[model samples]
Target: MLYIFDLGNVIVDIDFNRVMGVWSDLSRVPLANLQNSFVMGEAFHRHERGQITDEEFAAAVCDEMGMALSFDQFAAGWQAVFVALRPEVIAVMKQLREKGHRVVVLSNTNRLHTNFWPGEYPEIAEAADKIYLSQEMGTRKPEPEIYLKLLQEEGTPADRAIFFDDNADNIKGAQQVGITSILVTGKETIPAYFANNPC
Candidate 1:
C-alpha cells in the first residue's frame, strides 16, 4: 500500500495570517484588503506550475496589492508563512514506511515556499520516500491532470493508495482519480485516522 501526504498544513504548519501581517507592514496595505484581494488565480497557479519566475509572480502580486515594493520585500513576507513541522504527521509517515508501505508527499506549492522549508526543516525531506511538487510537475491539485500524472509516474493503481490532504477540493480530486483520500482537519486527524483504521 502507498500513503501519500500533502505538505502544507498536513505535514508542516503554516500561517497565512503571518504572511498578510508581514506584507501589510511593508506595503502599508491593510491586512483585510490583502487577505480579501489576494486571489489565488492564474498567476499563482502558473507560478506553482513552474510557468513563471518568482520575480514575475511577485510583480504581479505587488501590482494587485497596490504596493510599491521590490521582489525581495514581497518574498520576505512569502517566506514567513511556514510556522513549524508537524511531528505527529511525520511519525505516522515513518510508521507506515516501517510497515512496508510506500510514503510520498504531493504538494500544490510554488518554488519559493518549497525551497524555503526544506532548509528550515530537513526532516520534511526525510519523512517521505519521494516528494511530488507542483512547481516541478507543471500542474497542481484539484486538477485531474496532476493526479493522473502522479498515478502514472508512481505506477501504483489508484485503489492501492491512500492520500491525505488539507484541502477539500484536492480530496475530491483524488477521489475522482479513484484514490482513497482523507481530509485532514487539524493536527489530530491523521493520528485519529490511523488509530481508528489501523493503517
Candidate 2:
C-alpha cells in the first residue's frame, strides 16, 4: 500500500501567527496590516505556486508591508513559522516504512519553507520515499493535476493509495482522484487512524 501525507500541520506544527508576529516586528508594520497585505495577497499565492522567486517575493512583500529589510532578513522572518515536528506522526511514518508501505510527502509550500524544514527536521527527509512540493511542481493542492502527477510518478492506482492532509479541500481533491483520504484534525488523529485501519 502507498501512503501519502501532507507536511504542514500534519508531520510538522506551524503557526502563521508566528510568521505574522516575526514579519511585523522586523518590518515595523502593524500585525493587522501585515496580515492583510501579504498573507492574503496574490504575491503569496504566486510564490507558493513557483511563479515567483524568493528574492522577488521578499521584495514584493517588503513593498506591500512598507518595510526595508534585506532579502536575508526577510527570508529568516518568513521561514520562522515552523515550530517543530510532530514526533508521533514521524513515528507512524517510520512504522509504515518498516512495514514496507511506500510513504511520500506532498505539500503546497514554497522554496523558503522547504529549504528551512529539512535542516530542522532531518527525519522528514529520512523517512519519506519521496517528497513533492508545490513550488517544485508548479501546482498546489485541491488542484486535481498535482494529485494526478503524484499518482503518475508513483505508478500507483488512485484507489490503491491512502492520503492524509489537514485541509478539507485537499482531502476532497484526493477523493476526486479516487484516492482514500483522511482529513487529519489533530496530532493524534493520524496515529489513531493508522491503528484502527491497518494496511
Index of the highest-TM-score prediction: 1
Residue range with the least summed lDDT across 10 consecutive positions in model 1:
63-72
TM-score of 2: 0.93
Query: 28, model 1: CA deviation in Å?
Result: 1.7
**lDDT at 170, model 2:** 93
lDDT of 2 at 110: 91
Candidate 1 residue lDDT tens string, 159-187: 99999999999999999989999999999
Best by lDDT, which number?
A: 1
- Tell me the tens digit of each residue's lDDT in model 2 across 1-199: 8899999999999888888888778778788987776654678878888999999988988887788789988987878889989999888889999999899999999989888889999999888999999888888888999999999999999978999999999999999999999999998899899788886
RMSD of candidates 1 onward, in order: 0.9, 1.5
Candidate 2: count the clashes: 0
| Model 2: per-residue Cα lDDT at residue 151 | 94
